[model samples]
Target: MVIGDGILTPCISDSIVWISAAILVGLFMVQRFGAGKVGYTFAPILCIWFLFISGIGVYNFIKYDPTVLKALNPKYIIDYFKRNSLDAWISLGGVILATTGAEALFADLGHFSVWSIQISMCCVVYPSITIAYIGQASFLRKNNDLVGDTFYKSIPGPVYWPMFVVSVLAAIIASQSLISDFLHNPTIPLSRVLPLCEIVHTSPKYAGQVYVPEVNYILMLACLGVTLGFRTTAKIGNAFGIAVVFVMSITSCLLVLIMIMVWKSSLLYIIGYVVVIGFVELIYLSSVLYKFKEGGYLPLAFATILMAIMLLWNYVYKRKYYYELNNKISPERLKEIATNEKICRIPGLAMFYSELVQGIPPIFEHYVKNVPAMHSVLIFVSKKSLPISSIPVEERFLFRRIDTDGVNVYRCVARYGYRDARSEEEPFEKILIERLKDFIREDLAVNEGERLEAVAREIEVLDQACFSGVVYLIGESEVVAKQGSNLVKKIVIDQAYNFMKKNLRQSNMMLDIPHARMLKVGMIYEL
Candidate 1:
């Protein structure tokens, strides 16, 4: 029997396990919210957990016999490998399973300063884990025939329960941090900017993280299975640690490559990064090879599936966007449009805004069909939002002037925040009004401020005029007929029409009015 095998051992208690799990989950939430918010509170809890575990490790280290230190020699690893090459490799596979979540380190980098994570790893995690490993080696030395999770069972009852709980919590927080990272930080911009990157209105919130409810729940389930399915620490540890090391090694290499490309970095920086990466990779790889066959496949399979899903989802989504984006207006066409508007002949300006920056937008067809009378047009192409905000008033709503034949073609756009009292001043509808005022003041020799006020009044009057007439499109009306008039369509149309009507009235801008010839355009397809 193992020397520590008695009723006083910690493995006999279940309550400590649950407590540890709860604390770890709480800390995980802290990490998820970010250090600025909940991390401070979580720090103490994490510290306590680490201290308690570290104490146990230290106790074992101090009590162990001196002979156990021999295992630290490089010859032990070399000799063991020669004697049991296949077994060693298989054990390493298990260690690879242990480190499965190591990839999350990069993902969680945003939550804390890089310095903090590195500090925590060096000062807390690495030291404690190494101490524990050393203690395990000591325990094995005292009992050569011992197997399985005997290392954990060797602890005194007072320490056993607390350690078990700590292990459970550590596993959970490690997994959850990865999920939160993906949700909050995606890798790409949500959309393109107009003319320049500066034209982008707002930065994407989730620049590197993604939130997939299905994946989250699946991970939770898997974690629970592993917890209950295999109740021993050593068994799970062997399989769980290797994957993290592999991911870390790969990312380290990737980081080095990225730095070289970005900075044309010095050889010293390259070498330093390589050494650190190499060390961690080597350590993890060695550990994994030490324990592969028992249960390493569990985390390996989990990571494989995770990566596959991420890649496949991105591929499918990108394909759909690319298909829709393929149709675009060329630079030559824009130049031709400028020429056709007679910028040399026009009196004012023609201002334009394209919500979609990738190509000439679907709305350009509307311009071709209407062919409004204008002199010079200054087309200000603007980017589009996904579904268009419902705000009543917006600065971008101002008017713009397009130059054509020296005459000005005025085009106004309105950008609204949403359907609320605040939206009245921010509507997209005022883009045209602002542009027209500027043209009148600068080009037409009108008082800048007074002319803008007058133009606003005129826009109000024209909008009132539109109330008397109905706005309609000209060609290809057959498609709406074929789509079938269902309850959902009716409900959507009614809501949209009502929303638009309310906003237009509030802005004093109507879509159709008397004597204004409610502008008609060609067929409409999915824009």
Candidate 2:
């Protein structure tokens, strides 16, 4: 099924092929090692590529012959349009090629500051491109030939080869970057998460920068198909341009909604962003729509498929995540875990294990039945995956510890990402403790063969300040009873039997009704 170059006649130029190869190789290296540095290197190189093309475009424009110009006037553009309006619509299939690269811009926001991207666009990309496009216009008028081929021939010596190489590679890199943006930012912040609030919240890790493998692969295939199938830049750009404009148009609409109702700010902000996006989209749309007869439908068809996939994937992933979380809460087990605690002789200390931190749990009512006098200090324990490799101080601040009426409640919550949690064999608590020790000892420096007694001694001091007199583990009922405890031990165990019955295992509520003895209610809070 090898189609000869006959179908792709215009790509016979060795120079163009060589340039494209260089651009591809350069980007691959950049993607691997240039995460934070891409903007500095990439933006400048791209700007140069744009300027070089624009310069050729401008030169071609100024030197257009008068006779040739007469035939290529607006009439030719209109006639070509009118004669094949339907065909032009079909050609829109190719428009997908242009916007395929736009996702990369969003993905790279973290790598480069927003201001840096803007600066590169203004200083290098825009002006150079303006000149080249003008040259393209002029060249078209004089030669009555395919504009891409004309521009290629006009380049002096080997310069054409390098320019071609740069242009194609830059285009592909740009495409890959856009795909990355979508994977990292899944939520519709203003509309879904924070509709009433003006400011949107995001963790530093979930910032606008992201990479999407699916989108990248799809784009690669689409771009390769267009390149090998058509061989002429003009034919590809026509279709690519339309798809780019369509995506831009949708993005503009979303941005406007965010600016108006979501942000609900002033008119100046709205108009400025809208106008810029509008102008760019309009230009591309005009190009693709006008060239419908040549080739455009190819991109439009591909873009429609891509957008549908994006919408569906987000919906399913979020739903499954929440479902598993709610299923883990247990009432009966939480009660058994909370009740078996040892009341310390130390006056202010209180230690008990219960899965209930938030909402109604059996442990809260149990405190009312057993001990009328609540202990002054409370320690709540939870089992989760290991601590983060490096816990940023900001992440540590997420927990709130407070003292009320000589009683201290320490509520500990643990977290684990999907990769580590999916392993079936290992117990979570052991992994969690190891992680905590690693985090606490992260900065300690000692020879590998040397004992960690000195570091351990220092860490114990810090731990005493944090862990001190009473420590409780909220775990299973069987584990709590079998562990064996008396008043002497500072540690308290909570099997969380009630919590397991209520939340996780879902037991009958009537069992605790008749003999229901409620204890002095401790702090009532929900997770």
> How many residue pairs clash (N, CA or C atoms closer than 3 angstroms) in each of the candidate models, in the order given?
126, 85
Winning model by lDDT = 1
RMSD of every prediction: 12.1, 15.3
Q: Residue 484 of candidate 2: its Cα lDDT?
A: 40
Clashes of 1: 126
Model 2 misplaced regions, further than 4 Å: 1-30, 61-111, 146-148, 161-165, 172-239, 262-333, 340-410, 414-527
Over 1-527, each residue of candidate 2 has an lDDT whose tens digit, in order, gives 00111112112222354454344334433343323344445656666677678766655666764244454467875786598986755444453342343433443464457897788667766666556655665666656667446657666565778877786656554543442342233435321221111111122332443333333233444444555666666665565455456655666787799889988969998788778878756655665677666765665555455444344333322332233245333444433333434432233334344434442334434453554443444445432322222233223212223323223344545444212331336543334344445543553467754437655864454355335433332222221222344532212113222232234211112111111222123342121
TM-score of 1: 0.56
Could you estimate the TM-score for every candidate?
Answer: 0.56, 0.49
TM-score of 2: 0.49
* Candidate 1 structure lDDT: 0.47
Per-residue lDDT of model 1, residues 1-527, tens digit only: 00011100122123245543444334333333433334444466667677876676667667765466777789988998899977775566554543343456676565556897898888887787677666766666676576566656657688788777675555444444444553443334322210011111111232223333333343444444555565665656555455455556667778888889997999998998889878857865776655557655555666565455444434433443453356454555654665663423333323333344345444454556466432233344343322223333334444444434332333444443212222346332244445544545554447778767766664454444334332222221101212555765444333432343234222112221222422333343321
